[model samples]
Target chain A: MTTLSNTQELPNGPVAAALLAGGAGAAMLGLATTLAEASAGVKNLLVWFNPVGPLSGKTGVAVITFFASWIVMHLIFRGKNVNFARATAVALTLLFIGLMGTFPPFFELFVKE
Target chain B: MSISPREGWTVLHGMLFGAAFLLAFAGGFAGLYSLRPEWVTAEGIKERILRLKVGLWAMALIAWATVISGTYIVYPWYRASDATSARSILLADPATAAWHTFGMEWKEHVGWLAPIAATVVAFAVTYYGPALAKKVGERRALMIFFVAAFATASIAGMFGAFINKVAPIR
Candidate 1:
């Protein structure tokens, strides 16, 4: 067994940062999916295509939204310098999406469901 | 005997819930280890991080599947089941409805908290961890995020199990 030194400091490198990013992205995808399904409007819109019929359509939208949002998020942040403001913007955007789905008014006015 | 739609949904819900827990265990280890690379002296830290990245991705996907499946199981499948609705139960028998609605109404929303917390932590860890490492130190920030991720996964898993028990399709 490898004995760990309690005093040993965390190594400074890009690897840790990248791993953290990747992990975070994965977790966010899961959350985004739940948010998407919570918004009935999003479901009705996605289900219009009827990819897998009524039963799995919500799951389909969620899976699609998660991947699509991940791609978009990476595209926005890729190769660019990310700071506090930009990070906050991304988090707020996610939060806004989630909160919007929870709002009845948004769905009542715009979403058919 | 052939399985009813409700029974099938119950099985699917249980399977996905179990898968999420399994994935979370693997991913949680990798995530926590990633925060403190010094713990893994056996292999190259960077290499471990790359190989283990799949754990988090898989965990995320499974978590998504579990949430959506649970939602579908609870709303559509339960609605179609012969069992009485939670609303009706509340009106008829307040004591009995208390048990049912806790899972359907309360736990359903509570289950979302895991994902919400995960999302916020993910953005911060990815974007801000590096930036803030200069001031507060990288290890501290990462530990916070890693622990948060694990906590959320555990919460989601617990919620999954609880909902399945309280609101199983009859």
Candidate 2:
């Protein structure tokens, strides 16, 4: 073990941005998955690519949400500190929603007969 | 023995890219776990940080590659509407229908989370660099993200393997 006398401190904003954005992206995917099951319109709308079917749109929306949210949050919080703990909690909640949304047993509940 | 084009792509996506990400997880996890100011000297951190960055970035990239290839290439074949398609074969029989309904459904969506989470972890680590060692809370959060990435990938890879065994995409 070694002790360091000097360690530079950087703002936590960027990390917070990443965490939040990741969660947002994941939540979006889950939302898309569940919605696709709930409505035929959503399922068809998500079919961005023919071969890949609705998966293309589902993932496309997620990728877009992740990057877009990241950029927006980064710009707002750049070089600044925020409540890291709060950010983490929110992100985790979003992630949980994402996980549940993707699970077939869970999403299938929304399926229309 | 020679393999068909579809088989070759399947091998490349699952065996090459997916396996590489899974295999690298141990090293990355260990590095992240041990990345503490008390655990290593300043000089030691410099060395470990470089290796960690490289490994994390590689894992992230490989994850992206795996999903993209799986989604755009192999998935089309597996999900084709033809009677011989993997999805059709699985759905054609009640015994195997659950593989598509449950296994494949969870795998495809959850698999995507791995790359997204991984990229976030990679970016955070690179952004923080050696300073990450001192920030205990931040480091812990990153570890959670890393573990999440690994867990999601494992689910996808496992189901992918099982699904292929049950009904290959050929």
Candidate 3:
């Protein structure tokens, strides 16, 4: 059995990757939401499932972006050290964008009509 | 008395999955916050880490399940084009129109972020394991993600409850 040690050294890169990927995923959702509101073409394009309408494409793309970016970043950042602070800052900013973009008061501002 | 299939699914998505996610956050947050050398012995840390791993992952999965069910199953029914549909019913009255336009729209979109953030927190905690206690910066970042996940889910859940009350999926 592998005994876990409290003192073991671990690289912060993977955590950074996860953080950045999370932010990117969130940002993508925000961008998609706003774009969908702003353009009929974007809304129509995002109707991946007719029943769910644009939400299908919006969420599907966000999930895909999350996993895809996580994989890519994990590969790049694994076994390496990175600036955790910077990555977290970027992530928070992206998260804020996501929150604002989803808010009706905010996203409605971008409506094409 | 029994519920329709749509109501059953709505219950599962909101009450079972969403509520579970919310309830689990307190445990996960407490565990994460107290994971320190001074706060626990090595043995205690090990036990806590295991609990955190299980709890965090469960929360993440529940978050995903909630959003998936909401966006796919329940949402279609809510947004159906007929006048009797929830969205149409809400939109039919200027007084209740915001329930669909604002509440439903925000809930659906912001809800996706919860899973993404929760997954990140879970991955970070599992990847680092016991060593996370020593990584103050990393731990802080994970907590932020965890809290963000909770906040997003809470918004979605609250709106979901209200929307259902004002304009039920049934």
Candidate 4:
């Protein structure tokens, strides 16, 4: 209990279980984010009905950078605690703001292009 | 793009967003309490339970009051019966006109959807809530919350439809 071979110490029964579950949740969330990213079609789908030409436009450049960072850290660096959180946060922030932009033009257009 | 008054998509998405957070929170609470009961030092789960309850209440109040209120002020567009606003909108210039038309359509869809979304979210809370509570040994309270959630949501859904028809948010 006292001595740890690694940086994270070995935990007791319920503590260990809790930690494991939290870790699993974080990982699954990361995986889900990754899957959403992998499908590239979603971006196109948004702009499809949109009067806007592209999903990212100027803001989209930001999204790509976030996605790139997220992928490098999670898939490549393999889920270091801070890295995973940071990467996912970047991707999410960009993605959410990016999606919100669609409303202005789409809401204006009575029908589609 | 005739935005149906029931924009099930956006409302459903928002509800799901709230639901997902609720579940994750519940799961964290139950799992944490079950394993590490010591971490909860203060007047613990009571506050947490109250937080969840308050969340739903706040959502319901805003949803009915603001969303539907806004809808009624602009109800002429959604209801063909109320052609006054509709004709005015038709008279606007091209771009502004487009926004009025589509924005109004989006408003209609989002209007019908909000309460239904709330109801679904409530049902989710009830189901997942009890399940989480049962996992942590608070089976009785969990059941009560779950049942209340479902019942409240069902009523909300029914009322939402009725309100939209009677008042008709444009």
Q: Pick the candidate with the highest TM-score.
A: 2
C-alpha lDDT values of all predictions: 0.45, 0.93, 0.91, 0.34
Clash count list over all predictions: 0, 0, 0, 8
DockQ for candidate 2, C-alpha atoms: 0.69
Better of 3 and 4 by TM-score: 3
Kindly report which residue stretches of model 4 are placed more than 4 angstroms away from their true locations once superposed: A1-113, B1-43, B77-87, B126-170
Off by over 4 Å in 1: A1-70, A84-113, B1-5, B15-19, B34-37, B80-91, B100-102, B110-160, B163-167
Candidate 2 wrongly placed segments (more than 4 Å): A1-3
* lDDT by residue for model 1 (B4-95), tens: 77667656655655355455664555544454443445334434444444554555455556566666544554444334643344335765
**For model 1, what is the alpha-carbon lDDT of residue A53?**
29
Residues B1-170, candidate 4, lDDT per residue (tens digit)?
55544444323422443233333334423532442224432334334444555555455444444333333332323333334444353434564454334443333332332332333233233333322222333222223333322333333344334434433334
Evaluated with lDDT, which candidate comes out highest? 2
Arranged by DockQ with the best first, the candidates are 2, 3, 1, 4
Candidate achieving higher DockQ, 1 or 4? 1
Listed in order, each prediction's TM-score against the native is 0.52, 0.98, 0.97, 0.31
**Deviation in angstroms for B47 in model 4?**
1.8
Which candidate model has the greater DockQ, 3 or 4? 3
Q: Model 1 Cα displacement at A66 (Å)? A: 5.7
Question: lDDT tens string, model 1, A1-113?
Answer: 33223223333333233333433443443443444446665445544333222324433444355446556655555555445333434444553454343233442344234
Looking at candidate 4, what TM-score does chain B attain?
0.42
The CAPRI quality class of candidate 3 comes to medium
| Angstrom error at residue B136, model 3 | 0.5
Individual DockQ of the candidates?
A: 0.08, 0.69, 0.64, 0.02
